[model samples]
Target: MRLLIPYINAMIKLRLETLRLSVSGRITGTVYINLSKVFFPEETWNDFPLTIFNWWSHSFLNGNEGDYRFMDGPFYFKIIKKNGLYFLEGFFDRKLIVSTELDIDEFQCSLIHNIEILLNTIKKNKWDIDANLDIELLNENLCKLKKNI
Candidate 1:
């Protein structure tokens, strides 16, 4: 039994390392909100920008992590990664509106695509340069448009 325990521990460690690698990135993505539920019922859904320069910087990413909260704007959300699956939870004034597992790769792709669209729109508007535009601020605004900052 003792010998089997060691093997089990090693396997668990390896699995954890792989899971960590899967999510190891800048952690940029937009969290969509059903504003109709939070605000006017006639309104549709909206996206909220979210970004973590280095998600690993958070203590939860270290080991046996707990829920990570998002406390910005009128709404709130939480992110949780368990056994390699990433879950996002959305709330409005402490009431849960949505909870679902997210595919990180897909989310990243969507984020990048939205960023490209933003860039193109800027170029189309001839606001790419000489407008004294703040790139960082533009990025933030672009994120708020549906991607992450």
Candidate 2:
């Protein structure tokens, strides 16, 4: 059991990061104000269904900054300001997960960062939508965004 722990952890990390990239699609260049709202909303996980909402609500209620868990693995996040721009960064077990730069100013950055963090957490956990939820529209929107990118 002890020997399998490392392998299990690595597999989980790979799957989670792959899902994150799939959802976020490796943003490049500067994200303007208009696009920022679309890509990184006030609640990034709002588009997703109930599991994500549970995760977000738990995180929000706990107020656990810099340290969180997804799929039983530890993760961390931070909102960084550099050159008058904001960046939302994610890390898994001290390894870099993603560093997304936002064009928004410092004032509005935290809200976006909070949402991004939650969204990433949702992706990391591989939460699936329930059958009752209308996920087609969400999939369509994500497809459109991917095509635009």
Candidate 3:
């Protein structure tokens, strides 16, 4: 039974990371962000969907004072899907902070697929990139993952 639990966990982990080769040529970044309001389809295990309301990027550059500084990225989004049609689900700070349903449009589906690839690449090793801390990105990803019905 203990071995089964470990196997189940490993399977779930793999499922969360595996890229859907069937849906290629789109998606990017460290996390999945679909513009649609629905993350999971009707046949999904959960109710809430996935989405990304906004995203911020921080990059290192020379500041006006002759020092390196970071700048925030843009924050814009669209509704990709209607409801109930996504694979991945998440929580904030390890708790069910917010949840939303997503609907993946053509563009969003492409983006989510690419993001899965990016996430897999990042998991190969660690880097100094603050890809997870940008407010826009956090807000967007959080909004997509945890929005109320």
Q: Give the TM-score of candidate 3.
A: 0.25
**Which residue pairs in candidate 2 collide?**
none
Please give the RMSD of candidate 2 to the true structure: 15.0
Model 1 agreement with the true structure over 8-97: per-residue lDDT tens digits:
100000111111111332112233322222321112222212222112113222331333333334554455677987655555566666
lDDT of predicted model 3 = 0.26
Which candidate would rank higher by TM-score, 1 or 3?
1
Best by TM-score: 1
For residues 80-148, write the lDDT of model 2, one tens digit per residue: 556764555555566655555533333233333433444555556564534223234333333433333
Against the reference, the lDDT scores of all candidates come to 0.35, 0.34, 0.26
Deviation from native of the Cα of residue 16 in model 3, angstroms: 19
Error of 3 at 83 (Å): 22
lDDT of 3 by residue, 1-149 (tens): 00101101101111233322223322222232321432211112221011121221111011101111111122112222224332222333233322333232333334334434345444554423434543335344433532321
Model 2: number of backbone collisions = 0
Ranking by lDDT: 1, 2, 3
Model 2 bad stretches (over 4 Å): 1-72, 103-149
Candidate numbers, best TM-score first, in rank order: 1, 2, 3
Error of 3 at 2 (Å): 62
